[model samples]
Target: MVVTFDVSPEKEGSVLNYFYRQLTQTPAEVRGIDLGGKTAIVTGSNVGIGLECSRQLLDLGLSKLVLAVRNVSKGQAAATELSKDINLNPGTIEVWELDYASYDSICSFVERTKGLERLDIVILNAGIMATEARINPSTGHEETIQINYLSTALLAILLLPVVKSKRPLAEQPGRITITSSDTAAWAKLDERNEEPLLSSFDKPGKVDMLNRTFVSKLLGQLFLVELAKRVPSSVAVINMATPMMVYDSEINRETARSLMGKIVEVFRRRIGYTAAVGARMVVDAAVKHGEETHGQYLGLQKLKPMAPIVYSSEGDHLRSVLWRETLEEFSFAGVEDILNEVNSDRKEIL
Candidate 1:
């Protein structure tokens, strides 16, 4: 039976909790061996799902890992925490500074890693769910859109060349995995809201929780479809649908302090899966082979096709527009220069 949980009275509010409860009841299977000598860059991995994902990969024996985080201190702490469980070689976890809100930071991240001997994996796991007033910073874009979607797109492009250049050792090509959400099912990608998603944050009072979740979820799916076209056979782009209310690092004690937090906390505790379990889906997608599974959305530890609406012509148009707009915003031409420049300063960057 397809189990579902009624964690919250409201549809939007229940997502995170419902997902956690359902996934735990029926977790997915994982298969893989050693990943020694392989390299992966995971953004916003200082905590939460990103941290768990990194832990899993490290335990698999990754030779080197680039942990892209906005806070150097937090990154160091997370790396230290992860090292306790896994055999982390000295300097195996390299911390790189990256702010998804700033194109400059994204450019700098790609440029710095250009000289890497080989890059086998890139996980676009950073995201934001801010309901504060709208502020674009110097990036000239909405905060959520900038951090969640734009920065990710730029990262992919910057890394694409690198993934393409490296020869797959033992015939296993490099991989790029993105963490998405089920909210995509209701996303209105083609239809521009009277107010952009960021507008809600500008007027905190006007913010609607459900709307933000749904919009972010849809953008993720659109990104996946568009990104698939650019990745080569040796490179795979996989999107993981994270359990909404998992009681992992993603929903910590901080979420239980306020009324909303208390509600979220109750739901998660009663129905959600743990962080480690949720991470298995992401890990599997990154390592799983077989063309039939490529370029697909996955959920509940299996290949669940995207909603039909996701394929509507509107999704197509948005995909094209978003792709072009993102490329222009980040200045695609600067990627190679950025990578080359960063590599030249390798001694200090590390």
Candidate 2:
């Protein structure tokens, strides 16, 4: 599992600078891409970048779009708004209920997808950033960790076969676009123990809420590394996209209420891309296809090298440990059988 690259200090620093630049960069305009007759599912599509992504997809001619949201009422409102705004044809958009905090909800969402004749794209866009540590009652993990990392991973793995099965009918290979963040580069997880990192949150003051968010995103990148290895290229292509700093979203609002949060918000407002611009990165990652993008991290609408730690020996170890512990968490939540069946299917296909 030692993936080596000859990265020089100068090159690494340059990449770091490029990522910093993305905080202020205006995303390139997406154009000329046709998604006609294609079907896409976007989680958390009720607002923010997810909603913008759904709008863009519909405008680009996707035949069927599912807006998966925790609030079905809001999702229905979004669907209605999008249909009118885009002057969408009747029945082009549908809303479904999904609450990542609940394992049953995730299962129900996946089961519903089985009814689709073909699923061309899956955007794992639902996530949260908590300013305080709180445990999810159902998962017994920190709220951010459960929603952003664990649940997102569970849903992505379950949908692998559904997307893969449609590859043959797809104009191009099906895609699973993971919405990650540059903040993942800031996470520093303890590597000495076998216990899942999020479990440590139960101890008082052990987990920094912001740092937990970083770790959750880092876990997402790690999951993609393992996922790319297990599935065939033709079956599915998984990649992570960093929207950088998106302003005016609910996540940003959570960070903007405190004094320190206010200062950070000012800096973000001075440089960060608008929610619409950030959504372009997600849309490009979803509709664009290429071998180079598989298992890669994309930023500002282009494939960029991940944080240096992601390629280091320590990173390889973390990836392995995270993958194993993640499955264990899923098992505790009663998805071990599903995990085994998916892996068995992937092996047969590969």
Specify the highest-TM-score model's number: 2
List model 2 lDDT by residue over 145-243, tens digit each: 789988899998888778866655535778889898877777766532545554664455656778778878877887788777766556667888977
- Per-candidate alpha-carbon RMSD to the true structure: 7.5, 3.0
The TM-scores, one per candidate, come to 0.80, 0.89
| Candidate 2 least-lDDT 10 residues | 1-10
TM-score of 2: 0.89
The lDDT, on a scale of 0 to 1, for candidate 1 is 0.65
Predicted candidate 1 versus true structure: per-residue lDDT over 1-350, tens digit per residue:
12133221234324454454475465564646688888888887988778878888887888888899999999999888888856566879888899887777877788788878788888788887664435576765556666676677677767766775664655665677788766666554433542333333334355453455567666666766765654534444445455444675653443356688778778767766677777777777776644444566665665665644556686576677655554555564674454443344233434
lDDT of each: 0.65, 0.79
